[model samples]
Target chain A: MTMKIVFQKTSGLTDKPTHYCPGCTHGVIHRLVAEVLEEMGVLEDTVGVASVGCSVLSYEYFNCDMTQAAHGRAPAVATGVKRVLPDRMVFTYQGDGDLASIGISEVIHAAARGENITVIFVNNAIYGMTGGQMAPTSLIGQKTATTPYGRDVSVHGSPIKVCEMISVLDGAAYIERVSTHDVPHIQKAKKAIRRAFETQKRGGGFSMVEILSTCPTNWGLDPAESLEWVRDNMVPVYPLGVYKNKATGNL
Target chain B: MGKVLMKGNEVIAESAVHAGCKYFFGYPITPQSELVAYMARRLPEVGGLFLQAESEVAAINMVYGAASAGVRVMTSSSSPGFSLKQEGISYLAGAQLPAVIVNIARGGPGLGNIQPAQSDYFQVTKGGGHGDYHTPVLAPASLQEIVDLTKDAFDIADRYRTPVILLGDGMLGQMMEPVEFTEGTEIRKFAKPWATTGTLGDGPPRTITSLELDAESLEKRNWDLQQKFAVMKANEIRYETYLTEDADYIMVAFGTVARITMNAVNKAREAGVKVGLIRPISLWPFPEKPFLETRDRVKGYISVEMSAGQMVEDVRLVVEGHAQVDFFGRTGGIVPTQDEIFEKIMMAAGGVTV
Candidate 1:
């Protein structure tokens, strides 16, 4: 007799089925962001920037006004949008290679300028779209197509801790590193995403949540194995929790 | 505003403000630095936003973002800095965003000297970025035209929804002349229904993107872009002619060199050699209409420039071998003198009959 709605998809995401390979955690991360925006009820007034790599097509997935940016320039593009439409929410969904390598200058200066925007940086430890090339966030001994001999600290250098690096900027209002390894961590990741967006809604300035995602296809592992890989390998190197919180002076 | 003497670079900022440009993002580079500095000072007074970006790369991408957000936005740089902006520019073109880019060109190829050069002619007209797209390039020789074309550049950009370029040189960037902004000039509005302003209510969210994964779709996008370009070429092709009513030799130049060639035209007339000047204002369109009437009458056209014969290629293409296409140029920031161009006029006039 009772026809009531149960749990359903967020309106912040479109019904378009994702192109992500089976087991990749990008879909989960996208859902977290979309759910946060939907919960905040700012999806109608939000602009999302889809960056290069696998996330380059996020504009098609995110059910909001979106823009596809040049490789490594999403933050700069977000800055432009936020500056023009100050009342509207603007954020960039960037991958590790797009955010840490070619786009390092854009991200650093956008933080340094305290541009009123948010960055949802997805760090999968490899260039997923380019078929598993070593990323700027690749682990020390992790082997990708480019680092076929296992990443060597002697030549390849160590991976960048984006949350740690961006946290030090005076203009960065909030910075966090979150993981999607399990149900609990995924819940926490959603909270972090909400905090980043909330920080922007309050004009807190330059918020970023660096998500530790799993690239099962590129990592040469199944979905279950990939979650273990992130928990066993990535968590130790990139510890979870907020690195910088403008709200409680490092809450 | 009454006529006031201002440097060519400063006029660009002043006129842009009058044209209702709400945002300017640029990095400091010599020659064009004054444009950035002027914007820094003036934009705040006009309630506009001005940002000195970290680099040209960041500046152009900012412009791309602003344009996508549906506003009048622009960026300025020199040759070296402009090179850094190429990828972002390509992205803008791919998305068909409206933005203005001012290039106060200097010597180049590899950190070349900061002297004025027209060597960037190819870079401006022939798709400076990697794409099958073309930016409408405006080359204004005089300071007054700088004021006029700066406004026109923004209008053209907004009107066509394409990146419009103002191709100045070190000379145009530095020279001073009287310019007046017409008081209370109404800023024309263009409807940007396709912009991604994040204000879509109940409607499906729009995406401003250039990446079409499907080959057929990308080709269709290219076809649409080409059609827009065709419309722009039809409505925006601009150039000015002088003393060419019955000339035997036509001198072609743009920017500062065009001014010098005008003096050379007078000298050629004084020497009883019928010579004229064709100052191509819209350098990308190449002003083929002017040559259509004079190509048969003139013996040949001499392309004079501060660089080594870049625009001459376009001149030849337009002339179609009906008239000899000669080149008189000095590379590496060398500004050709009035007499130097007169000499080329005289040489081309030596034997050919009109």
Candidate 2:
């Protein structure tokens, strides 16, 4: 009997091993992005901007042309790349600390300018690279290194719902919040990533996919429990749905 | 081509466009606002990109992005705005991306005023960003020189694969002069096989990054950068000497201050006082050779500036105690008049005539 190969590495990804922690879900997100680029036949024409975070080394993982940006400046850099080479597809991979905390202005302004680029935002609700400090997206009752007593709303305020905030911008043509807590949600997240790229390929203005990810190491949970944690805690605050899709109707 | 009188800032912008810089990102700051406005109107006509970034920090990062894509890009700002861009500049230097930056310096220890000042001489020439790196800084004294330097800056940046700064002051930015746009100036293009514009199956995908987690690798990168800077120092020192031969006193100046010092030199010569001037065209690989060679002959050196004696430090370093180096400056946007500079030179020369 002849063995038919059902799974093989996509050309969009490089041969180097990833540095992501086990059950971190960042690996899954990376694979999804690479697969989408390969399937869309834009792997050779894509330019990826890696933000300063756990994914700071993402430039090595992506097979397409990549540039590493300073902490929180990925969107601005992506804006430059997209504007200069409008025909080339550009995207930024940013984590919660990078996209929501220090890089808020860059992300907002890039979207507001209607820059034709895609953004893949990974929100794991904590700063993963910097040893689990309190992140802007840390849950209200979640315990973190800085928020050892669990996040208190009176002290730390609330988590920023990025998809909702960005969807309201006039320049953002597509904005979706997806999760990778379950196999079904992972499939849905891949679909959202594809749609975001589709928006860019079709000349639609700023598109973003905010994927609710898990940080098992930082969250002090085992691999399996971390996915459940994301499903039970993160999904309620950041609802899994398309906040704005110009092609379809606004939610 | 016929010469047309244009504002210095406008000329710099137009010259950059002529040099094939199709992407410009900047913010509005006085003394350099005209450059941004000119780019806004002109870039579209040439099918280029002109984006007015929200801040200078964003603007420089945009330049970084465009440069990484293997294209000519630039940004312009005044002192405070330039300070905000230091972080991005450091990244660009670390990544070895080629780009041009223009600083129409205004007065500042902190937003001092909106007038011309050379206070930023140390910050720019000595690496304004947080790193052990040097950006090749070119100082232009006239509108024509500004245009020429702006064009040359792009080429030099590409040649070295490093950021080059065109450092001017408010006077240089706001003043008007007749600039002849010379056609067919030799434009040199460098091979950017390292740029992140997709490899197109030619090779592995390129990565432009400055982060090296390993201490040994990072140290090696720094050493390599220093070697490149040393090469620039050897090949790129530029200065103009006026009546330096058979003179007792030499005034070291640059940019607008150099123009004023020239007037002072002529006045001192009229009074039978032997005075010459050394105008440093490139401030980074500062014209140390001129100072060293003339140190023995000149009685004393007067460092003319529009700040609180910044460039004098570099002069002193080069002079190395061969002669006394005195500083004459008018700080906080106060430009020294011709008479004032001449008087300083007269005092430095011990009230003696040749």
Best by DockQ: 1
Candidate DockQ values, in order, are 0.89, 0.84
Weakest lDDT window of 10 consecutive positions for candidate 1 chain A:
A242-251
- Give the top-scoring candidate (TM-score): 1
Instruction: Give interface RMSD, every candidate, in order.
Output: 0.8, 0.8
> Mind giving the per-residue lDDT tens digits that candidate 1 earns over B1-354?
578999989988888888899799988999889999999999989889999889899999999999999999989999999999889888889999999999999998879989999999999999989978999999999888887888889899988889999999998999899887788878889999889999659577999999999999999999999999888889999999999898888899898998899998998898899888889999986688998888988888999988888999999988999998999998898888887778778878885333
Candidate 2 residue B2 C-alpha distance from true site, Å: 1.0
lDDT of 2 by residue, A1-251 (tens): 99999999988899999999999999999999999999999988999999998999999899999999999999999988888788998999999999999999999999999899999999999999999998899999899999999999999999998999999999999999999998999999999999999999999899999999999999999999999999998999989899999988673
> lDDT (0-100) at residue B244 of candidate 2?
91
- How would you encode candidate 2's per-residue C-alpha lDDT over B71-95 as one tens digit per residue? 9999999999999999999999999
